[model samples]
Target: MTVSAPPAPPAAQRTPPAPAAPRRRRPIAPYLMVAPLVLVLAGVLLVPLVRLIVVSFQKYGLDQLVGGRPSEWVGLDNYGEVLAAEEFWSSLWHTVRFLVIAVGLTIGLGLLLAHLLAKVSRSVRVIMLLAMVMVWAMPPIIAMPMWRWLIDQRFGVLNYTLFHAGVLPTRSFNWFSSPVTGWTVICAIVVWGALPFVVISLHAALTAVPGELVEAARLDGAGAWRVFTAVTFPAIKPTVLIITVLSIIWDYRVFAQIWLLRDIGANKDTYYTIGIWSYVESFSNKNFGLGAAISLISVVLLGAFSIFAVRSVLRTAQAADAEADAR
Candidate 1:
């Protein structure tokens, strides 16, 4: 036991633990894959946005635009001018009116169509859905002109039918001569064009509703209206809200339809929505700076509305989740 302890296992033979291998870094393949998309989006969207903001602050004119030279910096002058103009307020009012009427009618009709599609036989539903898809696929530019032709003052199918049916006092009735009629036609066109997508989306949402829940409600002697209000609606409420917000945004910024049909009205000024006004200022009037300012204001207003809608929806959803958790 006292033997020299085998010389303490010779120091030279002792082995120390090796340092851990450096952690292999995560592969950057994912980031590399997305880099191109990020670059493209920045170029297309971010660049233009920055230019718009910059132009809005400057006194940009045709000379500056053509020469590619920086214009005089007019701090807030463009914004001030736009805000002080009566035309801006008038255009805003027109936009609001169009948004309200078009969105309301579009959503109402979409819900009706979605409900009908949900109830119908598979074949009929498929046929109706296909028809809707066709309409939705049609470009607005093409559809707008087609509508104009159909309602034209001369040789128009609508006027011909109405006159023959005794619904019109004259064989050639001018639909666009009066502001009331012009706006009505415009709203109708927007509603018709928007309906297909809304209906399809709502139909899809409706189809996701639990059949058991609906049947249970029915077995409990709940009427159709009661069953829909209590069971079906709650499930699709979020979808409806989202579609309504989207519709509002779409109708708020409607341009091609209004612009194409502006001259149809006796007073073209009557149809000057914010979109039309922006175009007129930028292109027609060659006041690019003022137009950009108008556009920025419109964007701010729409953005505010969108934020409110999103927040409301989120609150409702969170409250629902909380209630479920408590239950």
Candidate 2:
């Protein structure tokens, strides 16, 4: 006997899904959990920023510090003074130049090394990454002094080696003798320290890149440069922009490397960035108000320069992430 087959249900007669349960609202637990960190940041960052803004408007100095006198609000006089001073302008130009050279070299080298790291075997990559992390973990306070010793005029390894190798005519070469040579050394140190972080960041971005896209490019007869410019760069563009801005901010405010390398007796002015100059003015010259003003001015300048770029790149990075997740 043939069994009767059940007929399929009509399309319109089938029950629809239960409408996704209306996507329950995200829990507030995450925000609540982060409240402590927010409070800590406000205490750490906002408090000092508020104090700085207040001091920027006042004539606060050693006299006020010792005598307990109320700080007299000078109403932009400090700003005017800083704007009119040749020293501020000169120091500013020096800082700007340093920022350009240091950041450029750091990023360029970091990108090269990151690409090299990505191509290496996994074991080699892990070993090199650990070495880079060690360098990155070193504090500037310790590293700068070591670097200063390494480039010392009479006994520095650099000068000694160069002299022995006949790369130099003299047994000793003073790196701090001139601004050009001094800045070169400082930038070299800064770039060397910054390289690990930059390379790590770019390498992370490189690892996130899709292998299939790269393979497709290569299979289409695309050369290395063409593949990089077309496929590889788009994946890492956001990271590059973000790193560039951060490098600008970091290199602009470099203090230790410059301060340590400078000669205590002289040639200090020749290598002073705004940060070093600010410290000297604040403590040595005892011009607290002027130092605060200069510090504020530098912050404003850097903030203005990076604010727009930061917001734009963050959005681009987020979008890139979403696209990657979709893939």
Per-model TM-score on C-alpha atoms:
0.88, 0.85
Cand. 2 Cα-lDDT: 0.87
Give Cα-based local distance difference scores for all models. Answer: 0.90, 0.87
Q: Write the per-residue lDDT of candidate 2 for residues 1-327, one digit (tens) a residue.
A: 999989989999999877655777899999999999999999999999988888889999998878898999998999999899888888988988988889999998998999999889999999999999999999999997788778877778998898989887887787777778778888899998999999999999999888999999999999999999999998999989999988888888788777777862256787767888789988999878888998899888888988887888889999988988997
Reference-based lDDT, residue 306, model 1: 93
Q: What is the lDDT, from 0 to 100, of the residue 170 in candidate 1?
A: 92
Q: How many residue pairs clash in each candidate?
A: 0, 0
Worst 10 residues of 2 by lDDT: 263-272
User: Which parts of model 2 have CA positions greater than 4 angstroms off?
Assistant: 1-35, 318-327
Could you tell me the lDDT of residue 219 within candidate 2?
99
| Alpha carbon deviation, residue 88, candidate 1 (Å) | 0.8
